[model samples]
Target: MARRNHTTELGSIACDDLTELGAGKEGWLVDNPNLLTALDTHSLAIANHSVVLVLDWSDGSDPTGPRVKIRPTLSPIESEYISSVEWLVFDDIRVLALGTSCGYLLIYSLRGDLIHKQIVNPGRILKLRVRGTKRDLTEDTSSAEICVVMPGVVARFDGSEIQSMLQRWFQETHSQFWDQKKNPVDSGSSNVRLPYQLWNVNKYGSCADAAITGIMPPPLMELQSSQRYYCAVTIGDDAVISAFRLAWWDFTLC
Candidate 1:
């Protein structure tokens, strides 16, 4: 016979498979094995197989207890085996990203709506990391970025564009014209669709003859300079470390 020991720290909830959550205190965002938790103003996003679940945890009276759940429509192909998930919070809006075992990355809005999906690498994505600061000294500029690591490759997606599309989708979904009929030309236009641009900016093959094991970005302070350069460090299976630098300006122009 097997006995399960369930012990938790003070103020912590003892739930099964409470995997991930963003950093906060006033309200909590959590993901269990089957259910996800979200506050009243915000929705919790979780990926199971290919389905993304968005739950509202605001009861107005008791926030710690289970509240309500919302189901969003997803495409049949989008519901593959999810390998990893992460939340990207921009100001007040939250975006959920799911990485599939088939090397596909799917992005979703806080309302559980699919924002964008793309095949980032030919191999399975081992991990997903969101790098860079949320805001820079230039208020008009965006510094948020998403990093995806595979067997021997590292890919990056522009977070600013993803955020812009989510905001547009959220507004359009809530607007009075969301359900209105539109002309074929207006509905079939490619410009109206959200773009999933995965830039294969860097590779880790030349570092070693072995498979690449890990990839990481340098600290924010190290990358902040007049030239605006970013650096990525990768570890190879041969026990070798290689560093690569990416600059905003072209080297030929300098």
Candidate 2:
């Protein structure tokens, strides 16, 4: 079993994952929604809208800014829950991509002070996979592209190109978690390692099949501004905490 430990924050954090809930029992933001507890200076946004949900848990007090309510983007058409979110940079403007639990990607613009929402079509694909990893740390499209991984398949959006890189990369880079286990019953032959299982995305576009992994699991939705990125995530039933760096995107494409 894995567990998460909470850290102190600047003041208050905003609701990103849970709309009206906190993380865990021993956690500060435990089961807290709409309000952040013990978080550092961080911000949250979905797609492209004007106002950024900024948080600064540094003061260890209450928020001083004007109260803002995060209302769900309601519509007559039903939509699935959001699975992952990524922040992109385009020259002078900022872009947002909210990966839905149903495999749809919503694009937004965060230039100046407003957010503009738009839907993107992946064309022929019936389902899409959206997830983020802290390992990719570039200021380019590597971090921004929603890398779709399937059985022996990996594709990414590179400008007008849907490139296949993960298939080759996984064959060359990723592998089974433990290959050194010579004996299972022999406790002395092997040591207990962190749960780093490689899980695929849900079929209906939800993040259902996404299992826990690694000693310190990263957050699903990551917010980035300028050169910094902040993440709030957990591992197993007990949530862990950490911040990660992400790759920048190419805003050269209009």
Candidate 3:
């Protein structure tokens, strides 16, 4: 009974400490109802406007500061703030991806190092989504995509671009040389960006959230197996649910 009470007290203390840490400068987490959190195989991440705290995954008691504390440097003139966060996991590594109110995507390493930053849209990004699609089993082919969701727009980013960048980053042996040229902005070819499409889904209704759920062989058409179509879905306060068939020519309201 004594041990149980002691454990309970310790738990309460830890909870209070965590709340304080997550409260940012406001001293109350409730002040920002949109506080972001993400969980993956490695750790749990919590984010305030410009700061991200990563908690180590453990089943045993150990006292240590957060595994990582990433506070993105914001200029005094910038009013952008973090709005969403997600864990981007690859087979060998994972990184934290965050979206901002002013339309930026920031990727950071687990060691709290900023790896990449780019503007995703002109509006607030509501969610940073990572999804995988299996094209075929025997063909041993698959693809992963990142969906940046805004109020009325959903942009699809090819995962291979970011994956290729991280591959070169991890294997680079020359620290000084890579550091000078690592920023994609410095080199246009290695910009970690490729051809991408931003699908408009606001025609049906103002979407609170949206994404390309999946891509499958063109429906109700006798076309080559190489042809694929996107299934775009959205939800909003005005419209409970809406879907569209997206293609090169146009988006079919369905």
Candidate 4:
């Protein structure tokens, strides 16, 4: 198993301590790092601090082929800090979803373009995952969703709907900025509201005092028509596990 130290102390180390430990120099450390393979498996993303590294491994299992660096596009006065990241792929499109310590979720295309950004939580996001299956003509189904997991809350959003909203937002913002007759200040900013269904495991009668830390959707087989229903599971820091069932209709939770 791969292991890494996640602990850090603010105090300085003595020279004698370094000499006793092979005289090594001090180095920076990462807290709560995350790594995951994209759905395609040909790509991998690693997040540390305020940057994410997207690596392609198509050329014969080589670890060093090409790397793309992705960073949050913040205003000059804003700070950039990433806490987690996940891959979101739909049909022929692939994008990276980054979660920040300040409750911001930023989505970026493979070419490092900022596609969409929003604040999904009031606290740090602990985990993220893209749920739901692609549109299937033979099965006559369409269900694409994104799941955002944070302390004490699990928010679900429709993936296709979000994509549509972002496209419209980009066009309107661009036109409003260039129209000199209209006051740029009056153009008004777009705030993507939480078009999400939230699940609070804490309110579900769990005795655990800790907040929710992770969540996952039912497996694909369980989501099929044969199952007749869909479910999700959430984990809490205090070792409490909660499961929820929702009626499925036309690829949505009813």
TM-score of each: 0.54, 0.33, 0.76, 0.57
Per-residue accuracy of model 4 over 1-254 as CA lDDT, tens digit each = 88988995432223232232233434321222233224345676655665566666554644533456665654445554676678876655677887876777777767565666677767777667766664664887766777767776666777877667656645664575445433322332335553665555445553222222223354666544443334556665667777655433323231
Per-candidate local distance difference test: 0.52, 0.31, 0.71, 0.57
Flag the better candidate by lDDT, 2 or 3: 3
Predicted candidate 3 versus true structure: per-residue lDDT over 130-233, tens digit per residue: 89977577787766899888988888877877787776666662454555534333322235544456778787767888878887567765656665578888
| Worst 10-residue lDDT window, candidate 4 | 12-21
Q: Which is better, 2 or 3, measured by TM-score?
A: 3
State which candidate has the highest TM-score: 3
> Could you tell me how far off, in angstroms, the CA of residue 84 lies in candidate 1 after the best superposition?
1.8
TM-score of 4: 0.57
lDDT of 1 by residue, 31-72 (tens): 344323222243454445444445444344343555222222
Model 2: runs farther than 4 Å from truth? 1-19, 23-62, 67-79, 109-155, 159-254
Q: Which candidate is the best by lDDT?
A: 3
Q: Which TM-score value belongs to model 1?
A: 0.54
What order do you get sorting by lDDT, best first? Answer: 3, 4, 1, 2
Per-residue lDDT tens digits of candidate 2, residues 53-142? 333333343456443323324232544444444554433334344444333444333222113232332221222333333434454333
